[model samples]
Target: MGEKGEVSAVGASRAAESRKIINVVYLITALDITWIFLQLSVTPYLAKKLGFDTLWLGYLQTTVGVIQLLGGPVFGRFADLFGARTALSLACSSTVVFFLLLAVANHPAMLFIHKIPTVFMHVLPASQMVVTDLTEPEKRADALSKLGLCFGVGMIVGSMLGGHLNTRYGETFTACFGAVGNVFSLLLVLKFIPRTTKDPRTNTESENKSKSIFNLGEITRLMKFPGVTPTFLVKIVAGLPSGIFQVMFSVIAMEFFKLQPEQNGYMMAYLGIVQMVIQGGVLGPLTVRYSESSLLIMSIGLTSLVGLAQAYTQSVFWFCVIVIPMMFSLSVFNVITDSMLTKSVPSSDTGTMLGLSASVKNLLRTVGPTAGGYLYMNYGQSSIGLIQFLVNMVVFVYLLLRPLKRTEARKE
Candidate 1:
């Protein structure tokens, strides 16, 4: 072949591979949202129905996250040793089983205990790796944006569906249906995903060498990269608002506002729709036009405003009106922040870096829910907004002072 023709062919081949990898990530994100909605939309109602207190419900979910923090690295190592595809497939399949078990839990302890195993398998490290595996460093934002879009769309659908199902059929039925979705998602991964591993198909002695079950050292080394450290901090900061929103929204809807189960789901569905429109439909194109850093700042700033509104609003209708804009900004913020991290790190370390970050993020999440519950039960719903506003403000300051410079430098 001529030189130019040969180069064109090579580029096309790489592009095709990248597309396939992105498809896998999109599938994972779709499943992830479905699972999250199933958890968020149904779990609180179930807890309430079962006569569990706010603290008990929060403790149950927090226990799930605690296990995830401990399990994520072990799974990361397994992904490295086996293959990401294998680990991801296992994660998908296991989630289906756990969701089924979760469907049957009548007691709080049973529900809490059943939840822990699934948390490990929901390790986001795999999906993040799929993005890094597919795209070049310069193209990371575009790639991550696509993944984020899938999450946004899926979340909307899941929240809406969970609301419909729970309202129509009841919590147990909704949980069972979500399990079925997990099974379907597992099938999608099995059919679409390709294994990306350095090792050969056959096991070698070197690959079999006993590595420490917990390699704090290896994870620490990975974090030392300049690109990784700040990204990790960003993930930690991002976790607070997200965690608070996730845990507190349902509590406020169910407990303080005295909304029915379906009403609560519908409110979340509304948030999901606003977020999806902004993140999935708008943010990707906007990133190409505007400064992603500015968008990030705006999003965080707006979320704080929403948080404050959420704290003080007595009427659900007024709360929804304020929340519409908040959701839009949040959706954009997550896409931007994640794109930054995906762009910062090298492809080879994607799994380890994301796994470590997931551990830390989950740890923060563990705190947010418990704290949010405590605040809500004692001080009332306004406490959620106050805490979220403070945390996001701290994050916003850090962004302007530090990362804004980095983002501007990149743009220039």
Candidate 2:
């Protein structure tokens, strides 16, 4: 009886510790995302001040994308090897440097130089790794959806804060604010997040033998795992159009909508609010009621429809109204895909898989911006929606033709 009670005590203590770590992860994720949207709010004005044209802006994102493409898997492997706390520290440190450079940037060359540190900015992937580490397989989808809630909160606050500061002060002040926020994030990671114990499932001897950060062989081997390839392909195909739209959105706001910085901030905040409601209030119940495959298919279909609606909308009011379903679809789709990918791999490779996923999106960002810029310049904003509509429709049809295998599908 005494032995059983001691075991119960140990289990309870471990559970408490896991919950504490998860809560800290949520806090750090929210803070980091806040800094991101905050930086985004002022980047357009800074680009204009530096005399960047639309094509130049595309080139800027492409530069960061190229660096991240090389770094994503490395950082993911780093997390897998060293643990998420270490990876988060490195990412936060890079962000602080990036922001400081942005604050002092006076020319387009400086802007390009500043993005060099983005190679280590894998905060989101690392945080996702931490969550997957702690959560159970059956509850993973619901747990991951809460990250979207953090994202929404950060977006709402960060957008509003950045816009207010930039409008009231200037771009430099806004950049400095981001730098400070990330410094605090770094401190939180170091102080609050506990060092994770090695998973019993991990083969320490083999992992130690392959500790090189950028092992293409290892990444390739992981990709060959059952269900990984097709899921990754779907993520890339479905993500490309949205990725392009996101990278070029500031340009769209400035040129097409004629939005000033504060107005753009408010628009982002509105979108954030919708996302929060869906992820926080709506998605938890939906995940409980339906299978992930059903949710994935439904979200894709809805997103394709939203894309078609966005193609014809001319006024800001109509655009705002249309964005509600768009946010819901996007939030649902992202959570489901990430959950599925993590579950498909062994416990050891979660970070690496997420890193590969990040690399895929970064690859899209690298090419999508340049193409999106040219298309937006020549064909107007409607072309963006047209691409989204067409790509998502194809993907939706593909999913219908061949649904995910049982291995990939979440157990209800």
Candidate 3:
């Protein structure tokens, strides 16, 4: 009877811990929402104010991408070496300052300085790492889906609120909106996440043998594992279109559709709603029903088809209809792909691997803005759609031809 009581107490403790973690995820959604709000239109507004065009906007994104590519790994290593909570707290605190910089900057060039600090102090990867650390193996994908829902819901609120604010308040002052979310995220990190949870692998090793964050050899050795490389490539390729589109969307809507900031906000809100419904409520059950390989392949193929459908769509009504499948597929793909990658590596390296995942996306994102912007300017807005369609096709065909490699899974 005493043993059963002890087991019951343990179960209760775990349940309480899980609830706290989920609450942390909800707080993260606020941050994601604020971010989406700022990016929806404020970025382009600043660039145009500085006498820049789509190409210049692309340049800014490229610069951010380059910085993120390098800094992402460093932060990942920080989370691993120190702890996710420490890294996340620092990231949240850094974001508060970064937004302040954006809010006060007189010139567009100053935005680059803002992104420099952000390169090393990002919360998304760190936050995901936190959830990864707490979740069970079978439930990680579902847990990740909940994270995705936060992003989706945040997008809905952020985009709509951003539109309303941008229309009413103008650009520069509105930059501080995300800072509000940062305050809350920082508080949550300080209060809930543990100060340190050192990796056993590093602890077992000699202090001098611990790898440096700046060491190229360390990063190279990380990829030496069986499933890491291919998984990274798949995520990069599958995610590129969305990455490009994310930066380009506001610009495209403004130019092609002649949309007001509020209208653009509404469109993004609609997209967010679709993402929220699918990722938040439906992803877990669907994950149970299908293998990651099958779902990924199907989602990629259908997403390409949806891109093709969008290329031909001129009206907002039809565009709204198309957003459903696109959001569903992309959200599902992100969840499952992340699950696959995290399972590919041991627990100790989860932070590093997740950071690498962000780096690859950022690397591709560096080129995405410039290329996507130029294509939008010189070719046509529809051209961006065509490019996405083709890219998605390539990814789908490659995945279909190759057997999805599931390396020996080891839980941390």
Per-prediction TM-score to the true structure, in the order listed: 0.87, 0.96, 0.93
By lDDT, the better pick of 1 and 3 is 3
lDDT string for model 3 (374-411, tens) is 88888877787787799989999988899587554574
Q: Quick one: best TM-score, which candidate?
A: 2
Residue pairs clashing, model 1: 311-382
Worst 10 residues of 2 by lDDT: 403-412
Better of 1 and 3 by TM-score: 3
Better lDDT candidate (1, 2): 2
The collision pairs in model 2 are none
Candidate lDDT scores, in order, read 0.70, 0.87, 0.77
Off by over 4 Å in 1: 1-3, 197-213, 237-242, 290-292, 402-412
Lowest summed lDDT window (length 10), candidate 3? 198-207
Largest lDDT belongs to which candidate?
A: 2
Superposed Cα deviation of residue 246, candidate 2 (Å): 1.5
